[model samples]
Target chain A: MEKSSVLTVLSALAHDTRLDVFRLLVRAGPEGMTAGSLAATLDIRSNTLSNNLVILSAAGLVRSAREGRAIRYFARMEQMRDLLGFLMEDCCGGQPELCQPVLDQITCPC
Target chain B: MEKSSVLTVLSALAHDTRLDVFRLLVRAGPEGMTAGSLAATLDIRSNTLSNNLVILSAAGLVRSAREGRAIRYFARMEQMRDLLGFLMEDCCGGQPELCQPVLDQITCPC
Candidate 1:
């Protein structure tokens, strides 16, 4: 990923609301959740949620699909990988010991 | 890590100069690099670099030590793990396939 795109993803996740939104979506799994459900779960106003959803979608952290009358959002796991890869690229300059611990722990319990 | 600290780290890295500095330090490995060398490497002014370093340090992304007349900075690899862990905690809701690809790829080529 490009630097600007990395920055955009970082900026999008840097916020309290958007971060909550993305994480919640990630936990929600592949079926995902609707904007209404997200706002209610996070307890934020709809317009506020709407604004953050737009920002997250633009940053490529969240993807949405039309379902019936509402739109559902899912975490873009690939973008998450891209962001992590961008940061970890060239990491430690051949010193695997410095970062291998991170890799070992990265395998989630789930 | 707490959400606030996560936000701080995300915000600190969201900038161009600081991201460059941290990645350079990461590539530089445990020996790290001096602010002067970093400024020359990234081609930014000393004060500007100073400002970003302060921010990165405050965010717990970078650590510094006094080396005679110069201060050297190292990327806090553990903090990187903390940030990544926070994001991946409860990730996929028991769906390993959703995040395992990232884990497999996370092992640095080095």
Candidate 2:
């Protein structure tokens, strides 16, 4: 992925509220969450949540789908994987072991 | 890890020079590189690199040690691990599968 694109993703998640939103959506799995539900869960104003979601969407970190009358947002795992690949590639070219610790910690049973 | 700390690290890496510095240090391994060497490699000025290094250091993304008159910087993999752990915990509680694709891609032979 492009460095600018990676930067955008990083910047998008740098905020406290957006990071919370992204994690919550990730945990929500493919079911996602409607804007109203997300606002209620995070206890933020709809305008604040909307602003963050727009930034997240612009960064390709989150995507939304319309179901009935509400739009639900889902985390874009592919973009995150791409971000990790870009960072890992930096070390893999020289010392793949440099990323061994990080890769090990991120390994999940599921 | 604290959400604020995570945000700090993410913000530190959101910049072009700082991210370059961190990734280069990661690839450089424990030996790391001096500010001058890093500046030369990235083709930026000493002051620019120094400013970025300060932020990375403050964010616990990198550490510096004096070597003679110069100092070398190393990427703090532990902090990266913590960041990953915090993010993983987000999904592990509800859907560990959310992070599976990312983990699968990052799995290395080493």
Candidate 3:
């Protein structure tokens, strides 16, 4: 990912509501969740949720698809992975041991 | 990391100059880089770099240490890993296949 694009994605995630929404969608997995469901679960107004979704979409972190009458938002796993990778490329100064905690946290199921 | 702290860190990295600074420090590893050097390399004013450094320090993404007459900044690797892990958990719907690109990009020495 380009630096500016990655910055945009990170910026979109630097908000409480938006972060929560992204986390929720990540947990929901590739199947995703409908906008109405996200709004209900997050207890955020539809207008506000819509705005957040727009930002996420613009950042390419999430993609919304029309499924029936609802728009389902799924985490754009590839873009997200790219963003994460970009930030962590040189993590722990090439000593993997120093980054054990991070690796464990991400890899551990529990 | 708490959600808020992660948000703060992400927010700090959302900017062009700050992100470049952080990435530079990360590439510099534990040795870190001096404020003046960072400013010169990035072609940003010292005052502006100082402000960005302050934000990065506040977000716990960077730490400043007094080295001789100058303070050097290093990437807080643990916090960075935490931030990356937090965003990447449940990535690719647990298939792991989908996140291969991200992993390769980060782990590849190229």
Candidate of highest DockQ: 1
Separate DockQ for every predicted complex: 0.47, 0.43, 0.36
How large is the C-alpha RMSD of every model relative to the true structure?
3.5, 3.6, 5.1
Model 2 agreement with the true structure over B28-60: per-residue lDDT tens digits: 876789999999999999998899999999999
Q: Residue B34's C-alpha lDDT in candidate 2? A: 94
State fnat for each of the candidate structures: 0.62, 0.46, 0.51
TM-score of chain A of 3: 0.80
Indicate the docking level reached by candidate 3: acceptable
Model 3: share of true interface contacts reproduced: 0.51
lDDT of 1 by residue, A1-110 (tens): 99999999999999999999999988887878999999999999999999999999999988999999999999887788667767876677756566656554444332
Write one digit per residue (lDDT tens) for candidate 3, span A1-110: 78989988988999999999998888788688999999999999999999999999999988889999999998876777567657766555665455444333333121
Runs in model 2 lying further than 4 Å from the true structure: A97-110, B96-110
User: TM for chain B in all models?
Assistant: 0.85, 0.84, 0.79
Candidate 2 per-residue lDDT over residues A61-90, each given as its tens digit: 889998889889988867776676676665
Which 10 residues in a row give candidate 1 chain A its minimum summed lDDT?
Answer: A101-110
TM-score of 1: 0.87
Full-model lDDT for every candidate: 0.84, 0.81, 0.79
Q: Per-residue alpha-carbon lDDT of model 3 for B55-100, expressed as tens digits?
A: 9999998999999999999887667766765676555456556654
* Model 2 steric clash pairs: none
